[model samples]
Target chain A: MTLLPGRIATVFGGRRWRSLAPLAVLIVLCILIAIANPNFIELRNLVRLANSAAVPLTLAMGLTFIILMGSIDLSVEGTLSVSAMVVVLLAANDSNGNDYGWWAVLAAIASGTIMGLISGLVQTTLRIPSFMATLGMWFIGLGLSVYMLGGSAIRLNDASIRDLALHRFLGLPLAVWVAIGAFLLAAVIQYYTRLGRHILAIGGDEDVTKLSGVNVTRVRITAFALAGFFFGISGVLAAAQLGQSHAVIGDGRLFAAVTAVVVGGTALTGGEGGVVNTLIGVLIVTVLANGMILLGISPYVQQTVQGLMIIAAVALSLDRVRLRIVK
Target chain B: MNETFSIRRIFEGKWTQGAIPLILLVGLLLIIEIAAPGFMTGETLALLFANTAVLFILATGVTFAILLGGIDLSIQAVASLASVMLAQLLPSLGFAAFPVAILSGLVFGILSGIVHVKLRVPSFVATLATGGVVTGLALWVSNGRAITIEEGGREKTAWINATIAGLPMVVLISAVIGIASFLALRYTRFGRQAIAVGAGEPAAWAAGINVDRTKIIAFAASGMLAAIAGVVLAARLSSGSPVLANQLLLPAIAAVIVGGTAITGGLGGVARTAVGALIISIVRIGMTFVGVNIFLENMVFGAVLIAAVAITIDRSKIAVIK
Candidate 1:
């Protein structure tokens, strides 16, 4: 009996260790890069790393919420792209003659939120799987963005938004602070609210949650809506960062955000992991990417490495016993 | 009473999961024929058949994976990698390297199967991981550049490009594979075991079936088929690129689903998937010929996918779609 308890303790410890594996890998990678290139330790480079990770962090936070509900949102890329394009086109000096101003930002975010809500409704009411529903949304968003932009990139001349992305305060860019704020907000909503608990319960067991009188559909729709808000904010930030917007702004964010969420110990099957894990995941990914750059790794090699990391992270985090069949 | 019972049995048999694809195919053809008078011309028909061939081949390969209740997202990546490998080895290894490249794809597929079966990871996550790795390999091997087969390579590609009595060779290959898969599923023990596993793994296991090995082989077979599709696609295109098969991922899955293959697993076969692929091809070609706006094309595709899935997915088999 003592032996069994000891073995159980060992297994528990092993799980905990695996959960922290990505963090350890990130720390080691950072140290190695610092040793290889002294410039990697510089404050400016660190800030740049933070800024680069901000968009992905925001997207990942939203994705975490969806994944926690045992659903996925593949529409993030499309929503982000469309929103980014909207921001640029509306705020473009030529397109709108610079008249939209701050309202453009608001409109851009609203567009994303609305798109999310629509996807949510389609999924909940039509009984379409979130995967397929969001995939449809992705196509719609991609098509609309392409049509609106006409394959042309729009330059943003909005001074305030530009400052928000480019200017630094408290030794960090505004985008980084925004990402941090989003992370904090996500944390609060996930832990402090009935909605968060309901979301988790839905993921744990949808039928049971419904039996408990939780408005399962409403919670799910709200989760998707929240994800859209984050995606919208991230898209606007991306436009501000580049000082331009193109349909490709959301091109690679999907994989990156999902990877971050997975790396942060979130279950893809949902009902576990949270914003704090995402924050760490975001840090690990950003640091790895920045470290690779600092170490002068080839872009192609970096892609392979990053992809491998994603696979390894997910493989490590997934609780296989819980799943009878994986689709 | 006997006659009526016999008639009902015939109706049920005829409707066995294959009706959806058949109807979709007929519907699409009718729409296209009405929309354009000469839509059935030899050239147009040939092109449509050719386009459907590769997709059909891919869907057939993916059918085995789906039959076992596991989805294979790695088909696109595997195909891409195989194509790149074929291009790289064509000069030195010539035709001899064809088998080698395909074998490499099989190896990757087996690895994916092991990862899923042994590691107990979900098929989606496992395939996603391996897909990323395969894509990375493709990118690394090709350096993101398109590789043409060169002069001598053109001869081999020509055979693939040439038609067998006015039908594309690719279509013939797809037909052969389709027939073989259909027969295998209908008669072979392997096919029955796959269906049994998908229908109820615990029951299958209790019946003393080696469920893990069956699934592994199913995935491996899927990989092999995807490789064949990739090689055929390369032969037709006359070049291999890292991104060649990126667009096929969703379409392949869509074809399988639209063919009445339950997404929850089991209860479909290769013949239905072939029809599904044909339906998708006709839709794509018809949309293009009808001058639908390119932007609206994607929306149309999505709509069609949703409609097909809604109509064909066996709701009773799926408790909840997460």
Candidate 2:
């Protein structure tokens, strides 16, 4: 039994093969859907698939770092909601006379960063677990968003900003392009920065990383901060796409983003995946949702499938031999 | 100086453990009374206990999981699922639906435990995923709508609202469960093993304690109790919906931590949870009484949760807080 577990761990433990499996699943899913419905591969459907994926992709990109370091951020939905409201109210909205355009978007992003920074501070300085801190942060964000919304939705009045969701370039919406840009930036950080490498090291083993003279606290905080920044961008894109904002706009995105990250083969225990994995994971999740609708499956079943996917993904990617205790 | 120093010493004494929540509860009551006179009426008191009973039950069940250095985020979702299932089962099963609802909780708890222990996923993530599945199940079963108990079914649960010696049955049931949980934790071998495991798993294993069994039992207890709470909620509301008990997760968690039970595990009990639940209930009702915006309620719970965890967490037990 011991030998069997270890062997399975090794097979799934290898980074190259681990990433490949998700890619293979994504391709298989696409082909199967195309076969089932010839229109699944049509440019419009594909564009729809990509459009649905953009927000989740951005959210997952931020979560990738946190998961990479073996921490979680349950505050994504909350952060997105708060930012969505912030961006809407600031950028020409029906509720307010303000029309700051791109500057409002920047302010909204800053709000997300501030929330992320506080979460980071709470996690590191207070010694609270990231889950608890972020969970608390989630409520705080929702409360703030709801307070701002004052019991109604805010419609975007800026045609230029709303066009981000309506206009398509290279057959993809501007929102999709923005998500791609965020992914590229994240990849650059992951593959070519000290912060990214240190995150991996910390996740591998915090004590060793600390003993090796790395500033573990700073790195962890930065990872969360970066995640918050991405959440901000996602909030902006989501609001832009819907052409309106409310406290509930960010709902269902957290599960989607986390699901994508895990489905892409990034270990929840940390140190085993990157944004590259998340990109594919986003596609997989999006394709699954899109295909579910195309095939006339209930959206309710989608949640069950995603929930099971997380458990199976985490179970399979788990590196048993490396840790003495599972908890 | 001598008297104050001795009082401080008494506060720090091991015998004084679990007293802080009680003290906080008293302090909050005093504030509420001052802010709104006649708030201490028997009717108002009854209302307070009624509100607290469901939360107390949830915290009681969750206390077992927390006592074992784990958490069951799925409890609230399980409770919702139980309520949804009970709503559907009540008409056909009459009063028999209660057990079936509670049993489903037990099964889910065991499944969560298995996933956490055998499958080796962390309890948080495992419970989270399971919670999501339970939520989906609830939505699917309820057709994403509230399921009202028919008039016939309502008669079956009417006893839940009946007064026993001037106390609501719901409040009495929660008290019984609370006392039972406290005794079980204090007297049972399994309870001792749970504490041992949470105190330190490796040492517990070395001591020949069935560590995995203890962990699984903790989660099972959590699930079952959450279901019981759900049943009571459905009884009170006369309906079950996918969203029933959706807002209770944070408060229940806050109740557990605020009761002086250490979030890191093995340092608290159901007695403490009872006190904690009272404190949380008062604070919630107190917020409404104070005219705080309903939207800010979640924010307050969030803040209180962070503050409570910070204060009660045993930093010594956790070398690394992930």
Candidate 3:
């Protein structure tokens, strides 16, 4: 657990070498890809990589809090779809005459927050596991969006909405900047806030956290709440970027977000790792997918590869002695 | 003394295992009768039994995994893969296609089990990963399209759509599977071992049980049943579809959990899960009968599912929920 023998970087708990492992692996992956295809290092491709990572990065950052608390949220796709549909329907769109402008953005975020609150309440008050609560909420969200949309896609045409995701600033896509800003916000929350520290403590030892005069339930609710807000924001951005919205808008993003969290050296057992690690995880996933696409790899094969990587990452990051049985 | 007494009570209370779902199912039926009086006819009951068959088969296998305190998210994916394989193999193998598809499912389940055991990875993640791979294989095999059984070949699979003595042949098949599984789980050494491992893994291992073998075998059983369900599903549709097979996964898992089998493991069986599946199908049908919004139905199902898990969960056995 020493600071790597005075190397200046505080490699916290260097005993397991986990803190540096994902980063090292990510670097190796980048180098290998760069060698295999030098075009991978090109600025245009790299920017596109960052742009793609933006939505997922926000999702991972939000989810990092929940995972830190040792709970899971499988409702991301459901909430994402609901929020996406909400924003599209509220904004100046083809499906409806209503045009709430920026207020629609607030509405979208509110929808996600509400879903998170329901998930949190179900877990804490009902004493149901987070997995099932969130899963149920996922179906609820999916059903809500599907029902509301009535099986139709709505195209958003708001200028402000387009600017939120599509506009470029400082030679970078707006989506990328939004993602970086989200990461910074999450970092501040993780390191400086009482709620964030409490989530980590609860994950580490729930009984100890409860005994120390901490409101475990409230902290958990807050974690899910913030995560929901971010999921909503990501959904809005994703829909805006695409200019079309439907119930399936966030179809496959949950796995990618979860993979980023676990691959970033965060123990699925909880209470280990931070946003910086997640950023590295997100980068690794983004780069790998981008590289595979550049190499003309088939989508089906890429799915298999990602699935394998998920297995490897989870197996490697899990602390065996601490976690004897995994359900 | 109190802890030991409670544990013994949980083990012996067969009535408690399915009591809640039974009450819920009865109440739901009554409500359905009152709301839509004509809907309780023999035809409606037949349709209910028919639709319940697929999920009942899926949940039967999931009950094994739940008894072992693990889960198999790969069930639906394995079923999907089996469907595609059955579709492709039928032209060549005809009647043998069913066994071949079932074997593929068993192999897929065993593969996931081996990974989970050897790597000590969580079954949740391991099954999910394997499910992803299976999904890919399905799309690849079917070339991402539905494969319809054509012409006279359809007649070979017609039993799937046939009715016997007023009930669909599918319902009869599920009943047979259910009866066999119920007997095996209640009377066999493997079944007892599954309960022990789920009730307390550390204690089971200490008491000289082959915990790993029991878990892996249970998972494999789950896969086999799910594959059978897929075969029947494909037959009923007269076509095999990768996507359609996946749609049944969540409902099946919900049925198993809602059936009063603890997610923490042990204390329920296939019979209980059968009740759970029946409850789900009834609720779905009853909602439609009452003119309930299908969207609201999803929300209500989610809420009810949460309540079901909350009521059935063995909190004392589990220290945390992830």
Measured by lDDT, the strongest candidate is 2
- Residue lDDT tens for model 1, B90-206: 888888768977887788889888778775666766776777778778888898788998988877667888888989888888889899989888898888898998887878889
**For candidate 2, what is the DockQ-based docking class?**
medium
Clashing pairs in 3: none
DockQ for all models: 0.41, 0.67, 0.48
Q: Write the per-residue lDDT of candidate 1 for residues A108-167, one digit (tens) a residue.
A: 999999889988887887676787778778877877887777767778898888887878
Candidate 3 global CA lDDT score: 0.83
Q: How many pairs collide in each candidate, listed in order? A: 0, 0, 0
For residues B9-42, what per-residue lDDT tens digits would candidate 3 score against the true structure?
7643657656867787788888888877876799
Candidate 1 chain B: worst 10 consecutive residues by lDDT? B7-16
Instruction: Estimate the TM-score of every prediction.
Output: 0.91, 0.95, 0.92
Off by over 4 Å in 3: A1-16, B1-17, B37-42
lDDT of 3 at B244: 60
Chain B TM-scores of the candidates: 0.91, 0.94, 0.92
Task: Output the better candidate (1/3) by lDDT.
Answer: 3
lDDT of each: 0.80, 0.88, 0.83
Q: After superposition, how far is residue A1 of candidate 3 from its true place, in Å?
A: 22
Candidate 2, residues B43-109, lDDT tens digits: the string is 8898899889999999999999898888889998899999998999998897789999999999999
Higher-ranked by lDDT: 2 or 3:
2
DockQ score for candidate 1: 0.41
> What order do candidates take by lDDT, descending?
2, 3, 1
